[model samples]
Target: MTIATELASPSPSAAAASSASSADSASGAAPAVPPLLVPKGEYPRPDLDRSERWQSLNGEWDFSSIDGEARITVPFAWETPASGIERTWLEAATYRRALAVPASWADARVVLCFGAVHHRATVSIDGVVVGTHVGGYTSFEFDVTSHLTAGRDAVLEVAVESPADKRSIVHGKQRSIPRDDYDGVSFTPTSGIWQSVWVEARGRTYARSVTLRGDSLKGIDVAVELAGDAPAGAAVRTRVLGEGAAPAAGVATDARAESATDAAGGLHPVDAELRLTADAAGRASGRLEIGSPQLWSPADPHLYRVEVIVGEGAGADRVVATTGLRSLEWNDGGLRLNGDRLYLRGVLDQGYWPETGLTAPSDEALLADLDLARELGYTMVRKHLKLEEPRWLHRADELGMLVWAEPAAPSRFSPEAAALFEDQLEPMVRRDGNHPSIVVWGLYNEEWGLDWDIPGSRRRAEAAAHAYDTMAALDHTRPLVENSGWAHVKSDLVDWHYYEPDPATWAENVRDLATGVREAFPVKLGPDFVVDKSLYGSDEFPRTGVPLLNSEYGEGYTSLERAWHLRWQTQELRRHDRYSGYVYTELADVEHENAGLLDADRRRKDWGGLRPADVNADTVLVVDLVPRAAGADIEVPLEAFELTVRVSHHGADAVAGRVEAAWIAAGAPLPASPHGEASSAAVPAVSPFVLGAPVTLTIEPPAASARLALFFVDETDAVRARSYLDAAPVEAPNRRGARPAPTPAP
Candidate 1:
């Protein structure tokens, strides 16, 4: 059934009478003016045949505050800006809108589709009860065909109630503060219809569901399930289309008599046979052989169109869907896609809007985000811990951006919680599986599920594994990340979380330490003293030469110094060979987390202010051990005077030692502590080391460094320190012997 009939208008006389009553109640005081709720654009999905006839019910609507059983703008709720009536709190609110059924949908089935409602929503047409929907994220539809008055406009009314401090439902990251949540201000309430409302028209016996499955290089396999009755000798036709290809079609005979069971031992085969005449059943099956399918990659996204037409004895209905082909696999090494090792360059994306909150203003706004990521050279994005509208996934598929789809985590998890989570997760996979851009299904994040103790941990892990297994069974095209961070078990990929910057320290301390433990000590006590399994089976798990990714990093507040003087320096420091990629704390300054790339208004803080360092000309100073013997000096020649020295342990820990340096001549002994107190010169040895275990020292030219040499000492002289020199010397012969590179304009 279509969404149109579901929201058909009430009788014209009834709407007029309701309008008159509303006017009388307002005493002609211009009533509350609801914000113009125009549809951002067309319906996101075109694959469904029913989507073609859908019309968005987004724009302007008559409204009133429901103080005493009054009416207001629908779907917008009373608290939101769009609702036009911004009451801080309301026990209950009613919203009404007048809509006329399209004359062309006289014979077709009409349906009303609501993208989402805040809490509990009850719908009525022409003052007659039609349907009710619970939950805030999932879409709901109603068959309004029987309730509509032919050729007359109808009144659609929705009543909504969203109470504060309710933990029964899943509300991710939303908090209620006593009149001061952020910057000492109370949190505002978010009520009613935060999404879109629309109508659709559909014919009888339409395609009910569809599944597209395939790998990166291989073409996708299409499977369909149809509903309604059809006679014998019916033909089911299917077509596949690409951007340049003319549509291709195939036909299958219906076989209605065959019986099949689903995975749960239920009698519902997604695709059922059609019984035409007595004793003769018909079923349609065929494959669309696509040769050399254009693989969908974050670098270059491509999509193909699949259309299916199920024909009865005389008539047929068609549904069209867009899908991409991609595959993901995990070997002993790491993640592989399309037979090649792929590194996920990703950022944690929290989809939010200032004006509309969760709902975007338009489709362009949605696509703009994808464009921003693409332009900034991010191929993948971890969707954080929230579910997005289906259209967001569609945009990813179309733009070719890889997605790590995460389930919204609740503070606690019970049996009921598990069931609700599964319900949301299953539909998410089903709706997005066809898109090649979605490569990973994330079940849990940061120990969100309740019960981290032994049995509880095991249960949560098993439940997460089951969810992944379910996704794999449903669509085996993508790999699953059982749990994102801690409380992880043996799953596809070993996921961990850390909040540190200093790349040198991360590389020497964290990365090397983690790798060593994963190798020699496969299992050990975790932070909570609980026995934890190894992230890798052996030392070779990470593959010594392969890139060890730091997926999550950077939670430090954006220093004003970094923004004004060292703009982009932090981001540039994160680009190293040993470093796969890092996700900065967030996209925007969220509450207390000021580590955002942009401000609240989405404007970049320091645009076109700084330039990235030239990787080829840059020199990286590496030292083996810390706390070198006091008064000990090492002589070294500088090629390109500009250098970034990094001192740290070979594990993941903060650098706690000290280093005192002096620029001795080519053959001169370092003067006895010429630079007194280590803090006298331009390059001083500061105490109480700032960075984690290993320290990173970035040196800019014009300071002091032609034939530079250094004397270093650790706090204690227990172990010998080794220093390695691996410099990417500039390709200039004249300036070879310890000469600094020319400084750039500040």
Candidate 2:
């Protein structure tokens, strides 16, 4: 929607960078494969990385599915055209691939890992059952050291079942039986083996996982988990580097440049080392203090390089991670990060692509979404109903994008389904909680698993509460919302979703919801039906003294009119100082949902030649005029119109700027050129006006149509925000169709 083209296209170099980190390139065991099936050879785990010790099994694999047996791509689901098995979703499938054990990895333990497998997966190596994983949205792994001999090939078989009855499992936007479910918002299924599968070599007594807990005022608490035959008193050494060091040695130059710079551009964070001893359970933790720490936020996402080593040199394990040192809290009825008020000018990201389903085409594809978010002037993005790839979160850390992470939810209510929902929270938190970009964790959305009857069923309310407590135990640093958008069973913030087409009414409801004057949220369950705002909330979570945000708000449609609705709807959000922030319905089109700034192909719509950031910037100009029909031009008086304008500044400091206005006729040059070029002088410019002041706009009405454009320019003469008003001259009643003359005579 914005004119800036900062996102990079997926290139062969990106794929090479990923595979080069793996040992397969050195061993030369992987067969030459078609680029179409193996579009990406990227590393799946940038966090907690031991890149060189791993081998990618992400290219071609022997595959079969319910839709009929065929060869398929490893990470691409069959439902997508990219997967050679381009057919309808298959509920069951079996994959067989050859796993070559490099002779150099003989002394280390070989662990098989899956970024994720749909619904249910049973894995076996060399005819021996290794492990089974349920819940498709979380990562799982197994150690297969005993089954394989060094330099020999082993058969890796994975049998997967993604039941058609998705109501019993955690499926995000993926559709199941009753295809019209989710109000027709569900999409093609992301079935088995949809994410990367790989094997990494680790020491027999190595660090399996490391958690970094960072605080700007204090320091970092490094927690290490060791697996395999670890000694009773195993020790872990933690070293956090300053701004310039790479995460590890032998990494590519592009990756090194990514890790070396801090977006905050502040003083270098403390570089130091601390050691801790593991007990019988093989756990170790220690805190490293930084005298002056650089905090991470959307404005500046500065990551601290962390390296941890376990055991001694001969049989040691090493892991490199990038951690952000930051802190957030509630203050003045709003969320604050790094002691500054945080207004989440956010967009809802569904994390889907036309060809890749949910899997990324390349590592750059993940960064492209964050790049789009930054271009649109969004400070945050609410990942709707999906747990995205770790590379996405890692790029958010690099590019300074805040995230509100939510996992997939079930479609129906049942005790078993509720347990499945509860079971998924721990892994979600454990996997994602360390990232500073993720400011909040959401469990369920709109009571989907509770059959949307949170008010009627006590059992449903208990399920929501159980999830709240489960996540509270795993993570306390970030805010937790049990049920987002309505009926907050247990949450740190009271957020709601109201999709009102009328700007005046949306403004009224948003102010009321923010002030507690309105307790119930208006629900638009479907196009033909409307449920009035009746259900306020249950008694489980109190609403008093909490931050209020409209987590979702927008109308459904496409193009300039859609952009028009986004502008007005979000204006109401920024107008109310009582509110914290807002997340628009979406960033890109998904399946049947057309309420997106960009299409499913990630291309901008025809927004009437306007930049989307004009209305979405952190510091924007809000004009006080309710919109008329979105596609139609307003019939203003022949000469002039009066309106009030104000600055809605959410930056860390107060805003200082001048507001400029100009009127240009149809087919005229934009105000962007020199103050008055020949083409631009068809209309005139208005004198500068102070913000928050009423100003009269005058125009010598052109014979055709015209547009009144406004801009907010800071002291540096750079335009920070811009808006437009389409107008046509008012016409008198038709004289030819004169029944009026006869009525006057009578």
Candidate 3:
């Protein structure tokens, strides 16, 4: 049953409801029309925004697939609950809508835009096929000026086909029936239009495209591609309205200016604007500097308001955007952001939602996820497999969050799949190149599209290297990870993924990998399969003098145990001064993998007594105690207990600090020096030292059950780090097999 009957006009107020709807989504509440039959109303393209001339076509649409017929939303995939038709996967679908170009814009050109559609999409207006676009994760557009009927409504239809097979296409983490290599990690497939769709009326002569880049905090460069009637004499003029800093609290101003600001208040007038004349191709580019340069970082993400106008006056094309200044460098010592040594406290973000699948329920939901990641004390999030939505990247820029972005990858090795994967690279980079928050571009994950055999296949290794070279050539501002997690044939930073659960074995293996003691390392792909990794790709592209990072690790049957592993395994990484950074298994759990700190719904899981923020902070105390299990505590008999203490400091400057030791008991008076100053000698920066003269604390008195605590207090009397051990005295011999006495209350 094909359903393409004409639908009624959309509500006039639907466009204005986006903000209120977003507010509802922020509080875990459902919006009015929600994602169904109503536009999310966000201008999808902030980089090249022309809000005054565009209209959203996101509200209502008639959808029919082979499996069924229903009214579906434009952006949400039919497989998601937000789509209004939670149908299962299908090969093909048709979307129909009725739109009319405003007659007042008769002299203008109307173009249809689809932010993204999975697999393939064929667009048509008034029964005439206009264009066809392939690939799932990237956006596409078409000019529909000739097909439009001006003031009268015209029937618009889109045909979408997403294949059942996963091998040939660059699918990333999206999964179908017959699973792919990463089946265990893959989530639900997104089919049909899964992002915003709209129509924009452009001037007769307009800017076709624009690009902005940060020139290492000194200045910014801009380029514009003009089209339509624009000629060689026409020019692209760029002006800085202000710097990248938000306004003060409670100030009413432009949302764009407000969201990108810091206390520095980067609103300075530019005395002069830079203009570049278009060549025969109607392309122009030039460099310009800001009044007061401020670099972007997690501490302060300042943005400068750059407006690029083509030609002049009211009919001219204008693109208002924001950019941040920053520089990145990676070497044997580690990564540096603006010349300051930085550690990547990162987590994996799969970019899936419970209700929306690949689409976020709302813009707030997007920000909320980043907020949650920051709450977990993560400085960077590796967008695994998928190139995240640009809005996610934009929000990351506003919040000063760093990103490790990767494009969608084809599952198998084939000329077709490789070509398809290569086809996706330039678009992905160009779409996201302007964002300052993105610091690294990952070409492949574990050699996924190359049959997971970069070492064995020379062609595959070259393909990976070629991908790296392509990305590096386009954007030399950031490092390129040829293949993350393992088998880095060509990479700016060398990273490996390990999931050894045992503390002793994990530390030993980490030390081996960090120290280059082992030529070959085993990569645990799943519960059954393991492959020995080599550096065959390094023969041609040497990466011997690169920084090392544990891009992925941690495995636990339960969340508490995972948190426990996170607590100590992180210390083990910091134990060696060689490690540049580490990214835990994930920030939020995906479908079947429960290794994330947060559950699938983006809610925090029970971590027992552990606090993730405390363990993940920049500065922390690492105690030398390896427990067999997370629930396993300590045992004592009225005797002395000894342990070593070390400081893992990533602060900007060194501080002289001493270790403070104390004892805590349940429902009992506090023991002495329990609050007194630590007896350990003061040491500056990150160094290991023994607490007390002989590094031993004697348990004196009534053999009371208690836990001893340690703290690192700096010379300024500020406590920089702390840790504690729960111990109870051993009980008298009994038939119960010498169980320890119950822990006392403090």
| lDDT preference between candidates 1 and 2, better one | 2
Cα lDDT tens digits, model 3, 449-509, are 8888887788898888888887787887888888987778888888887877788888788
In order of TM-score, best first, we have 2, 3, 1
Candidate 1 residue spans exceeding 4 A from truth? 1-37, 46-51, 61-79, 86-92, 127-130, 176-190, 228-235, 242-286, 312-315, 451-458, 501-509, 513-551, 559-582, 607-746
**Separate clash counts for every candidate:** 54, 0, 12
Error of 3 at 613 (Å): 1.5
CA deviation > 4 Å runs, candidate 2:
1-37, 65-69, 242-270, 533-535, 539-541, 631-633, 667-670, 673-704, 714-718, 729-746
Tens digits of per-residue lDDT, candidate 2, 667-699, equal: 243477224111111112222211233333334
Cα lDDT computed for each candidate against the true fold: 0.49, 0.72, 0.72
Q: Would you estimate the TM-scores of all the predictions?
A: 0.66, 0.86, 0.85
> What lDDT tens digits, residue by residue, belong to model 1 across residues 1-746?
00112334465345434433443333222221222335554664643434535566766555444455443443454565655666655646667787655444444445677777766778888888787765655566675766653345679877776656434344445443221112121124456776778776544344555677656355556555554333234455555643333222222111211111122243221221222221124334445556656776655677767766665332244566777666777664456677655556566676665555556556777667766665544567787666666777888887777887876544455666655555566556555667777877777655454433323555666666666676566655665666555444434665555543333444444545334443211222243343443333233333343323444555333443222212122323333333333444445554344555566555665422211121111121233322111111111223323334443222222223444434433324334333422211232332211212234333222222222333334445221122222112233245557778799999
Residue 473: error of model 2 in Å?
Answer: 0.7
Error of 3 at 54 (Å): 2.3
* lDDT of model number 3: 0.72
How far out, in Å, is residue 635 in model 1?
18
Query: Which 10-residue window of candidate 3 scores lowest in summed lDDT?
Result: 1-10
lDDT of 1 at 368: 74
TM-score head-to-head 1 vs 3, winner: 3
